[model samples]
Target: MTFSPDLTETLLRPLLRTDPHRPRLTWYGGEPAGRTELSTASLANWAAKTAGLLTDELGVAPGAGVRVLGLRSWQVLPAALGSWWAGLALDLSAAGAGFADAVFAAPDADPEVVAALVDESDPDTVLALSTHPLALPAGDLPPGARDYSIAVRAHADRFPGVPVEPTATVLQADGPLGGDAATVADVIERARALAAGWGAQPRVLAELGVTVRTTAELVAAAVAALAVDGSLVVVDPASGHAAGTVGADEQITVSHPF
Candidate 1:
């Protein structure tokens, strides 16, 4: 599955145009046998809304840096994709919050902890996600901080901004050797390579805390799955379900740690 240099053109737009109803991501975790699924259309919609929130409401401009915490949930997918859609540089490194223009964290994360990490940054720049299975809002956020699940809902379902530059830096991270920045072209190419290795339309199962660590890796994995018109089944290590059992149940064709 070869891809264009543009991330949106390669990974996102294609899915929306063809087979938009097909399930792209399926998550299994949370209390009381929780299961949630997002089709290609649904994922794209959320990404667009998130982009709208960043650009329209938060006043974050293109090429700005956005740091994301808590990578072990389905909500991270739309947020990561939306950042790219808005042409923001995503930093997934452990020490990214210091240099970020905005920070997104999980709902359960302590506000004080995130506040301490963001330091002098504006409290409004911090957005916390509920990670609700039904996409509910996270209520009772700290004063000045934004609720992602609530605020994002007010945005349009389609991004009304300019297309992202293919050469723009999309991700900043620590590569296998050292720190590196990946452009949209680089990410697309990496996704293509991953899809090639996974074979045609492979159903991949990955454990969030174990197999995946950073949101960048998860985004790459998602693009790989989408490139081949496949799907991703994500599970938390704490789900207490054996990988083999879940793989067999989900009919997963591949299982790899990201």
Candidate 2:
């Protein structure tokens, strides 16, 4: 159950080597946001492009925090991994998100809320995601906010990860259940533990709400799925698709439900 402490390398490099084209993520949502599947290579490419945006375009450095205010969709995976690719941390708190260097918001997020968050966090950059099935950029962004979908497309498809910092802070998931600042190695260790608990389960599904922001639920679920050589399925619970239906269709073996 040993794993690489470098989160980016642990998540992408091995998958790229072992089964690049194998399906890794499947997302199901409501109409116009149906089904989307990303292969290992596809997912890596997306993360790399996103990393390019963070590093080359936005000047995000290692140990910086990127606040993502979005639902559990296919895009979040790439966004999270991309942050890791740039050696950046993810701040998944429901509050105090404005303190991060950059912020990503979903379209469903209330404009007022986003504006307030921007005022509160006063981050240097804010990118609004349309969350379309086709991954289209938002046409009408809030003032001073850029469109993430459009910006990410201009980046390269591959990114050499930043130097590994196993002990560096990578996540902040302060919550009522229990929360702490975790390092890259700590996250990898937690993933391995979750994988061990899964035993022979083949696929891990994320059924938690976007509001349930926790490192264990967000990062660990995907890592554990990959640790077991299984795909991670992220579903929007309000997508008109039932959990049981998706589990049955997608061959889900385990779930981190709300």
Candidate 3:
């Protein structure tokens, strides 16, 4: 039976929570070169197989937590999903964020550990971890450990992950970017490009959309508010505007525009 996401986390209590490993996040550095796809189906497959290692093989308790950190490789995608499906409280942290990243109850692993994530997570809350690789600001990051990066195609792209709540928090955090008042045209243009990958009538996921004319800015704000979990902060255009206030708590999954 497809697990009902409606169950208040209280009754579910995470004892029976989980996530799939494979979900692709194409990697891009300076310019576009090649692309990679990390599908959820593949992630879930590996997550389930790996959990067998920890539970039936190694004897990691029912609710163990792991601190995850690493390079911004696409591999982190599966590591996060795998951790969740195994019923573990996965703590996602950046590599050099700060001292806070180094704390108790956090295990550090690269994205390669995707499907195996849940096996390590049990008893404790099954926290999800993911990065949208968007050019946006920082959103709510699951407080945990340092980050890392591994070579691409290190492990098998096949993992069997468990089905999770539809509304369950999947991925978190975006790389970084700048804010210089975009125009409505730009907003629409980006929405156009995003539509190429996501869908035609895509909904933006964001919090603040200040500028007036740019389509990227306007549609960005609209899509975020309409489709994703976000809030629209209407600011006074006359103030000349300072840098957009970015909070780890207020951000959504995708990164801001470039």
Candidate 4:
């Protein structure tokens, strides 16, 4: 497969190679999940390892389905980028989980739901993410399921993906609130437009909520910040820090506070 420049190429790859140390994301709160920042290089490394785990270990390929469960957090960004790197499409709903080649659930995911899903998903791979900055292993994985921290850590720091078609479906979210699937090319286009519209802002802070994933603007916003040589700050509710606090401390210019 030949390498193609889609969303990851437009946002991640070049950023990693050219401006690797530039801060991309900053998360502030407390304890195990508090005050975290990722540079382009740091985020790329995580995405590459995740891509390796999915493509090499799980046999995920172009057009493969991967469902991500639970709330938005730091982990979702890299994991989503990795899936796109591997040319796999992302699904964010339970109804789509059965057909997904792989499923990644956050540690705070409903235990019963995860258990049932894992039990029903035999040969299919299920990864439970701990979201700890230390990549700590989660306790009590369901049968046939694996810990994302352990699995991803085993992969190399740099896992470049195969060539992918720009038109290939990269994400889908058709729920009651209404959503549409976007191709790699489509997502890139939107990212560019958002970047241009946001002017030359150097930083953006946004609420990390359901809309971030469903609207496909999470990728757009992050890439937009990068387009202007800026950083994206995510306000995670679980962090216990108020939006006002993050905005004040981070000097956030654009945001929808919770």
Q: What is the TM-score of each predicted model, taking all chains together? A: 0.87, 0.86, 0.33, 0.83
Better of 1 and 4 by TM-score: 1
Candidate number of the best TM-score: 1
Q: Across residues 1-258, which tens digit of lDDT does each residue of candidate 4 receive?
A: 444664565667666667788778886632365677888988888888888898898887778888777644567677777887777888754456355788787665666767777877753478877656556676666666788878899888886665667567776755321246777666665555665545464678876662253323555566567656678887766667677788888887666311
- lDDT score of residue 157 within candidate 1: 83
2 versus 3: better TM-score goes to: 2
Q: How far is candidate 2 from the true structure (C-alpha RMSD, Å)?
A: 3.7
Summarize candidate 2's per-residue lDDT along 125-217 as a digit string, tens digits: 787776566786667777778888888999999997876555677777654212577777677666676677665536777764752354336
Question: In model 3, which regions exceed 4 Å deviation?
Answer: 1-24, 28-34, 93-258
Better of 2 and 3 by lDDT: 2
- 1-258: candidate 3 lDDT, tens digit per residue: 444321112111232233223222223221122223333344334344434433443344433543444322233334434444444433332332222111112122233343233344332232222233332222333333112211112334333333444434322222210132222233224434533443322222222223322222332343233222222222222222222432222232333332
Candidate 1 segments whose C-alpha is farther than 4 A from its true place: 1-6, 31-33, 107-113, 117-119, 139-144, 175-179
State each model's C-alpha RMSD to the native: 3.6, 3.7, 15.3, 3.5
Error of 2 at 22 (Å): 1.4
Pairing residues by index, what is the TM-score of model 3?
Answer: 0.33
Write down the lDDT of every candidate, Cα atoms only: 0.73, 0.72, 0.31, 0.68
Q: Quick one: how many clashes does candidate 3 have?
A: 72
